[model samples]
Target: MQRLVLLMLFLFCFGSLHAQQTEPKKYLVYLSDKNNTPYTIQQPAQFLSEKAIARRQRQQISVTTRDLPVNPAYVQTIKGTGVEVWYTSRWFNAVVVRGTAEQLAQVNALSFVKNSRSLNRISSPSATNGTLAVKNSSGTSSEALNTMLAPGDYGLAYHQANMLGATELHDAGFHGEGMTIAVLDAGFPGVNTIPAFAHLYQNNQVIGTFDFVTRTENVYGANAHGTSVLSTMAAYLPGKMIGTAYKANYLLLRTEDAPTEHNIEEVNWLIAAEYADSAGADVINSSLGYTVFDAPSVSYSYEQMDGNTTIVARAADFAAATGILVVTSAGNDGNKTWKYISSPADADSVLTVGAVDSLGVVASFSSRGPTADGRIKPDVVALGANAYVLNSAGNLVKSNGTSFSGPIMAGFATTLWQANLSKTNYEIIQLIHRLGSKASAPDNTLGYGIPNYSRIVTGLPTLGAEEGVALVNPVTGNDLIILLADNWRIQLTELQIIDATGKLILKKMLQPDQERQTIDLQALALQKGVYLCRFISGNQIATIRFVKL
Candidate 1:
């Protein structure tokens, strides 16, 4: 009776229950083990590319049996059962096959098979016919202060990159050259024809393309979402708009069948990640994440987002283990009732990105987290609110979603990594964590807060830099200014000045809206000596010393 109820309800990715009468065309069949696999860890050269092996070698990651290819003999047997095997995953030891319920049943009964679950595929005209192009007028909505080196560089995309301190990296000649980023998303409609991407074709910056959903080399013409997302990183239109990683190589892989929501997409992500690994990609940017499905029974609960429960999350972690940095979008569910990060974002090894406005304020729609295991997620945030992206028609426009934010960070990270080649992927993540404005106190809302670019290159501890407080340095006798991070979430409750002998020289109460405080050495007739300034809040205190001239 329970089996019939589940069948009637069409349970999806949650388990191995087969559909009763519904034609779940695709299925993921997990194998018992890689036993009898022809490949061995001794010769990873046969499976992993030279560059992939070099990456592992640089990171001191060893080649194990887990890196071996799936047993081809087992796959041959599954094919012998008349089921069309489309893809195989070595990480999950699984195969995605398409067949009738009866034919799949025979393959599932094989001794080597551990379990099988039906994957749903439902197509809608709006998503497939390119009618899902989101459009917004060219308007400015930003509160970020960026240091632009030239007006010709970055154009409108300046605020997004500069907000995260990426402009400094760009100015330092790290335009992501020699780095490769694999973008796994839905269809990219205008990538091949868009004017903004002409430079990519001229320079051969695009390494390859693949459609995991349709199983083809062609990755264009299904949805515009990927096109827009790619524009945030790959488009190279100087004096108009330039992507953060415009000089880096890219692999476009379509894994999401946008019209439907199901667990098969996660399997597709796993497959694409493997392909990227074999293709020698250094970074993987996944803007898609799983949360709910058409069938509520198969939908993921908040508990399943514990980083290990979801197959996609595990795949992300495995991809990261291969010496590749996996960056994903923390789902845009903050404003919704479900309100939490989706799968893959919960993955512990991935750099889960969240969305914030150009002004460094967390977006209302950006997902929140402290994972089910109590780990702070959304390692960082970027400009996603009214973010500028080129549409499928090759026109620069505006859009909203953590989808855009993830790619922005992905591109900046590429440039940053390119500038510093010796740093491991995890080391890069840790450095970003320490440079954030809120490094002293990371919260669920904004993990480590917005990163300061000046601090990244200088490697200096500027006053109030780690405390989420922005203070203008080189204070003179004229005035002093301070810009609080966020809307004063890291409030400045009070400020105290202590003289050379630890004598309390001055005390002042500060309101959350104080915005700035002026202390003049000339006005107070203070001596020219070193003095300690303490910025205190209810939660913590940050102190800095400055010598008065």
Candidate 2:
């Protein structure tokens, strides 16, 4: 009797659960034609639930910043469901829960909407244009191949190889030697056994790898996205493909779980980024985005792509401002309904990348962007078509996506930075933009176009010429005007006057009122023949030749 009663109650509950689930939950719509009637549900009641509607109107939205304070109302507006409706620096404005499918049909039937998707693995293949410095896959002793073969004079494969940034890095001598790059991705399978990557294993270039997903050091598993990304920077191409920074070090982070749906992956990414920063790394390249979540209620609308909307976005911005060069994939949803861009890519100050074919045209699937604040995105482009890549088993595979392009460009950037360690981050970015574009408008599809390394090497004008301080008069007590216009800036912190034989005549702090300052020289007792005036600045020192009579 007891067993029967339990069975009967279970059936009733199961039936009730089914009935409730089949009942119409709200349907989200994406308008195919954003130009006309951007909103599918115009009528207020049909567009939102009473509770949601009230929350939308009453909430305020604002970005997170310690230095920049936000308005209280804006913060209040963002506290509720309508908080997703705020705009980001990427120019994408998100909308909150508007209506159900039945209500949407009554409001306007001509819109596009679907349940958001869970995370998935995406990647681009390695470069395969011509012959790379082939390595012995046998894993025995070092073998040499005489006269490496460049790509044939004419072929699609050859052209594509030429389009890769590895070609640029090789010419610039930034083949990743003595530098470390950490790639935060999903998983890396069979990296330790691959013969093409055997060099890294033997040379200690594979410094360390961690799996943030499981909180373990084992990153080799079910995903190939990380394998492709890493090979682009470290794979040794004996005769087939060449990576950009073949000699550089690497760290792999597996943050995505392909078989699960949870927001914990984002938390994993943040922890990994902090780890990378603390590890004394010079660069961090991530090829992931967030615009969707597991639970229906937690899903993000278009308005939430704002720079400050998510936790990962804040971490990305912080990484860039801290002097670590960060590169991210723009995303792969060009023709899809959610064709805007993904989070972290939408973060301000990050080097967002787009995909381009061998012919220098934008890839059809490369995510397009004009951030919520109307800033142009995809700061650069790289080869991301059906590019050649190395698989976990040491075989060459062809893959396609913006994920591949990012690391290739990053390798080149890393190499260049290694060569010119003195350059500021902004200066390097501006130089690439000025040299890569066709001297016209930079668009969302291709931020500043692809960088041309040859031109950049020859065309980059030095920031300023070196100018030393000099005494204008050889006679006693002559006035001296220190001209610093030719130099970057010259507010000398300390000045020392010395005589010809290197004895200090007088030592004093010389304060410059401006870039060009005049100081009277009569006070110090000075002798003739080759006196030196030393000006000290932060991290920079200048000396001028002077004579006293």
* Candidate topping lDDT: 1
lDDT of each: 0.78, 0.58
lDDT of 1 by residue, 366-390 (tens): 9999899999988888888999999
- Which 10-residue window in model 1 sums to the lowest lDDT? 130-139
Give per-residue CA lDDT, model 2, range 422-453, as digits (tens).
Answer: 45455556666765655257888898888765
Please give the distance, in angstroms, between residue 65's alpha carbon in candidate 1 and its true position after superposition.
0.9
Error of 2 at 255 (Å): 1.2
User: Which residue segments of model 2 deviate by more than 4 Å?
Assistant: 1-161, 457-459, 464-549
Q: Supply candidate 2's per-residue lDDT for 339.
A: 82
